[model samples]
Target chain A: MSSLFNDDSLKSIAEAYEKYEKELVPEWLKKLPERMEEFNTLSWIPVKRIYTPLDIKDHDYMEKLGFPGEYPFTRGIHATMYRARLWTMRMFSGFGGPEETNQRLLFLIKHGETGLSLAFDYPTLIGIDPDDPMAEGEVGIVGVSVPTIIDMDIIFRNIDMSTVTTNMTINPPAPVLLSFYVAVAESKGVPRHKIGGTTQNDPLKEFIAQKSYVFPPEPAVKVAMDLIEWSIKNIPKWNPISISGYHIREAGSTAVQELAFTIADGIEYVRQLTARGLDVDEFAPRLSFFWDSHINFFEEIAKFRAARRMWAKIMRDWFGARKKRSLWMRFHTQTAGVSLMAQQPWINIVRTAIEALAAVLGGTQSLHTNSFDEPFRVPSEFAAKIALRTQQIIAYETGVVDTIDPCGGSYFVEWLTDEIEERAWKYIDRIERMGGMLEAVKKGFPQREIAEASYRFQQEVDAGKRVIVGVNMFVEEEEEDIRKVPLLEFNQEEIEERQKQRVKRIRSERDKARWSTALSNLKRAASRGENIMPYVLEAVKAKATIGEIMGALKEVYGVYVEPPIY
Target chain B: MSSLQSISEEIKAKRPLKVLVAKLGIDGHDRGAKVIARALKDAGFEVVYTGIRQTPEQVVMSAIQEDVDVIGISILSGAHIHHVKKLMEKLKEIGADDIPVVVGGTIPLVDIEPLKKMGVKEVFLPGSSLKTIIETVRRLAIEKREKEKLLT
Candidate 1:
C-alpha cells in the first residue's frame, strides 16, 4: 500500500491538477498548485486542486451568489463593493477621560478613520461612574470613562453626530449608553434615522468571556432583545445588536466553537423575537455580527465564507427570511487580541496584517486591526497609525478586492468552506440538542468546550508541536525584554478632581422633578417587562446621571455574583 | 548556590512545600500566572492561585490564611510601584516580613535590584522560560519548607 501511494502516483496527481489550471485560475498565472490542498481551521478537510462546475454542482449564480446586494449575498452587501463606496474604516478608539477620548477620536478622524469605535472603561461598562469606590485606580485606565450624558457630550465634542457611524463597545450598559447617545443626537438636531452606528448589545459573549456582566444571563438576553426591538422602530439606521464571536474567540474558543456559539446565540435571539409575535424580517435585517480574524490565515478566510453561506441557509430553510437583506450577514472583523503577545511586541503588526487580510478576503464590511503594542499597553498614536495604514495599503494596492467573493470558486476554498460548515453544524446541532445557546451557556456547554480547546492547545505548546516563535521557540539568550515604555497613564488627580465637579454639578443642577419622574418610570418599565430603551432615553433627556438611572434600575433587577470556579 | 542544595536536600527528605501564587491589584492578565499555577501543581508542590483583581490587603490576608511557605505575586498593569510598595509595607505591619515574595510581570532589570533589596526573592519577567519559572518555584518552595522545619 505504501509503494502504491508513492511519489510516482502523487507526482502524477500534482501534475494533473495543473493540467487545467489555466481555466480555473486566471490565464496570466504561470504556476498553480495542483496537489496543494487548502485546509480549514479544524485541520481535517482538504480542498481540491481547482473548483469548477463539479465543485458547486448545484450552485446557481443568481439563486446562490447572485449580484451584489442580491439574495444569498455570497458577493458584497452593497450593489457595488468599493465602486460606489468603500467599506467603513472604523478604528476602535477610546482611552482615558471624555476629553482625552475626544482628542483621540478627532485624531483618528484626521488620520482617515471613516467612523468611530468607542472603548469604554470598566466603570462605564458596569454602569457606574468614575467616582464609584469599585472604580478605584481603574478610572479612565484602559478606555474612556463615560459616566453620564455630560461625559458623552464632552466625548463627542466637535465631532458631527449626523455623519459619523459610531460603534459603542458596551454590552451590559448598552441600553444606558445608547440612551445617552440618542439624547445627545436629539440635542444636536440629528434625526434618529440619520444616526448610523451599532451598539455591541451582545451579552451572551459576556458570560463566557469578557466577564463584564451586570445582570445574570436571563435578564441580559431580555435587555438585548429590548435594544433589538427599539432600534428597528426608533433608530432605523442603527444596528440594535452585534452578535459577537470576537470576545468568545478572545476568551480561547476554537474557530468551530466560536461559530457554533455565535450562530446559536443569533438563533435564540430570533426565536425570542418570534415568541414576542415579531416577524423575523422585521428585526433580523438590523442584526449584525462581529468576528475575530485569528492567525490561522486560510482557516479564518474559510470560516467567514462558511459563515455567510451557513447564515443564509439558516435564514432561508430554518427561520425563513423572505427578504434578501435578512439573509445577508453584514459583519465587522477585528484581528485576534489573544494572538498579540508582549514578547517581541513588534511582530504583532505582522500577525495583525495577515489576520486583517483574512478578514478582507472573508468579506468584512469593516475591520479593526490590532496595534503592535496593544498587548503591552493601549495603542499610542504611533502604533494606531500603522494599524490603520495597513488596511489602507491592502484595500488600495492588494487587487484581491477587485472581484466579488474573490475566493468563491477555488476548490480549496469551497472544500474548506464545506468542511467548516460540517464541523460547525455538528457543534451547532449539539447546542440545539442542549436547547440552544441560552440554556447551553447556563449549563456551561460553550465554556467547557472552549476550556477543552484551550487545554489541547496548551498541550501542543508544551510538546513543542506548535511553535509560537518568541513564546515557545526561537528565543534569544541574553536579550533584554523591554518591560517599561512611556505608556499613557491615566491622571488620577485629574480623575478625582473631575469626578468631584461632575458629582457636584449634577446634584446642584438639572430638572429635579423630571429626573425623579423618569427614574420612577424606568423602575416601572424594568419591573413591568416593558422595553426599557424608551424610558432610558427619557432619563437621559432629563440629564439623569448614568449612576442614578442604573442604580434605580438595579434596585429592581438586583445585582448578581458569578459562580465561583477553580 | 548553597541555598539550592539545602532546598533540594529538604525536598528529597519528603518535606511538603507550599507555594502561593497571587495577583496584586487590578491587572487581570492571568495566562502566565495560571500557567505557573499548573506548572507548580504538576511539579508536586502545593499551590494556591488567588483569582482576579485583588488589593494588597487581600494578598496579605490570603498569604496568612493559606499558611503559604512562599508567596509569588504576578502584576502586569503598571501600578506595581504603588501596589508592591503597599504590599511590602502591609507585610511588615503584619510581622510576616521574612515571608518570601517572588515578583513577576513587567519587572525590568533595573527594577529587579530595587525589588531584591525590598525583600523579593526573585523577579520573573516576560522573557523567562517556563522551565525556569517552575524550577525557581520548586527551589523556593523547598527552601521555605526547610527553614520552617529548622524553626520548629
Candidate 2:
C-alpha cells in the first residue's frame, strides 16, 4: 500500500476510492443510474439516496440531537464516548458445565474482556432440570446448562459477584435465573443493589423470533414485569430487561423493522409497568437494547444512530423520563449470524470485522463478534480467540473510537438516520393501530412481515440485483476442505445422573415440612395475584430447586401452549 | 388425502421420486431445517414439516399418517449418529423400516462413512445443492421401495 497521506497527488485518488460518482460524470450519467440499480444492500436503501441533510430536514438539532449525557442523548450516551472511557468491551461467553463456563469467564477476563454475558443451554431457559427427558442429549451442548441454584453457584464460583456485570441471555426462565443469581449473591454477602447485570427478558420477541420461550404470552409478560418491579426495588444496578431486536434481524427483518419492532416491544413493557404504577424512570434507566450488526456498513451505522435519536425522543416525549441515563440508548451489538455462510467459512472473519466496524461507528456500548467457524458449529477455541482479537484490534489499533460518532456528519449517515427513523415510526404507528406488539405478534403480523422482507431480499439476490460476494456474485469455483473436530464434549449421562443424585440429596436433606410450607406460600402468592418474587426468594433459601419453584408457579399460571406461528 | 396423492404424483412425475422431510427428536434449530424444507418444497416434493421437537415415534407415525414414501431426518446437536440409528431401529420395531431414511446437518465428513454403514441412504451436508438433494432422495426412495417389494 502506498502512503497516500504523504503524497498530495495520491490523496485525491484515495479519497475517490468511495466517490464513484465523481468518476461517472456526464458521459456516465446515462449508464450510471442503470448500473446503480444493480447492486444494493438487502435493506434496499440505495447508495446515493441513502443519506443527506434532507433526510433530517425537519429535525431541530437542539431538540432532537442534544449533547450526550443530557436530555435527548443522540450524539453519545455519556457526553464523552471514549474520551471518558472506552465502551465496555464485553464478551458473550458461556458453555459446558457451570464450572467450565466459569473457568472460561476467568480466561476471557484475563484476556481483557471487561464485562460478561451468559448463554445458558435450553434446559435452563425453559425451566427444566438438566435430567428432564426434553433436555436429553442437549446438556452443555449449545450453551451452558444451569439446572438449579447449584448450577448458578457453579457458574459464578470464585468470581466477584458484586463487581462484575453479568448479562444473562435467558428469556423464559429469566426470572428463575435472576432469582438464583440473587440467592447466590446473598450467600456471597453481596448487597443486592451492588450487583449489576441485564437479563434477556423481553418475551414479546420470543414469540416473534428466537423461539425458546415457555409459558403463554400473557403469563410471560406478567413474569417479566414481576422481575422488573422486584429489580427496581432491590437490584438497582441491574437492567431488568434487554429488549432484543437482534433476533428479529436474524429472523430476517429489515433494518427498519428491527428498529420499529424492538422499540414497540419497549413501549409495551413500559405501558405494562406504568399501568402497574411503577415510575418509568425507576426502571426505564435499566432498559437496555440488543441489535444485530451486519455487513451493510452505513445502513447499520445509520440504524444505530437513528435508534438512539428515536429512543431518546420516545422516552422524553412519551414516558417523561427526566434522568439522562433513562433516555440513553445503551446497547450491545453482535455480528449477524445469518450473514455467516457455511461455504468458505473463513471469509466470515472479514464480514465480522466490517460488521463490528459498523457497530463501533454506530456507538455500541458493548459488542460480541461472531467467529468465522460459527456457521458450521459453536466456534472452536482458535476461532473464538480470533473473534476476540478482532475486537481488540478494532479498539486498540483503530482510530475510530477516538472520535465519537465518526459518521455523525457524513451526508450518507445523516440521511440514513432520518430515513430509518421515519420508516420505523411509521411501522411503530402501524403496530400501535393494531393494538400493540404483543397482539400483533399473536396475530403473526410481525412474523409475516419479517418473512416477506426476507423473501424479497432473497428474490433480489436470486435476480442478481444484490451482490453477496461469495453467494451470488464474485463466486469461487472450488471450496477448500473444512477440518472436523469433536463437537463440545460433555458427559451428558453423568451430569444427569449427578443431577438425579442432587435431587435426591436435596429432597432428603431439606426440611420437607418447611419446604411444603414455603411451596404452599408460593402457590398462594401465584394464585392470589401477589408479587411472587418474595415468595420465590423464600423458597430459594429453602433450597427449592428451579423445577420446584417453577412447578408451583406452573400450577397457578398453567403451561403455555403456543398457537403455531403460520 | 387427495391433495397428498396429487402432490406425490406430481413430484414423482416431474422428478424421479418423492421424499417426505420430517423433524425427529426435540431439537429446535429449525432455521436450516425450514430453509431446506422450503427448498425441497420448491423442488417439487411433498415436504411434510413435523415442526419443532417431535419424537421418533411421532416422526414414524407422521410418515404413516401422511403415507410419506421416504423419511428425511435432519439432526444437528451431535445426536445424528444415535438418533438416526435409533429412529431406523424403531422403524423396524414398528414394521416401517421399509421406508428409506436420509440424514443431514452437522455430520462430520468422517462420521458420514459410519452413518452410511448404519443404513442411512446418504448424508446431505451443509451447502449441498437443493437440486442434488431432491434428485438423490428420489433415487434412494425408489431403490428402497423396489427392494422392499421384492422382499415381500
Best by lDDT: 1
Candidate 1 lDDT, tens digit per residue, B76-113? Answer: 65445556777888999999866788888754345578
Q: Best DockQ goes to which candidate?
A: 2
Q: Alpha-carbon error at B141 in model 2, in Å?
A: 5.1
What would the per-residue lDDT of candidate 1 be over residues A25-85, giving only the tens digit for each residue? 6553447543333432433344454454445444445654566676556666777776656
Comparing to the true complex, what docking class would candidate 1 get? acceptable
RMSD in angstroms, candidate 1?
Answer: 6.1
- Would you list the clashing residue pairs of candidate 2? A52-A415
TM-score of chain B of 2: 0.79
Alpha-carbon local distance difference test for all models: 0.77, 0.76
Q: In order, what is each prediction's RMSD in angstroms? A: 6.1, 5.9
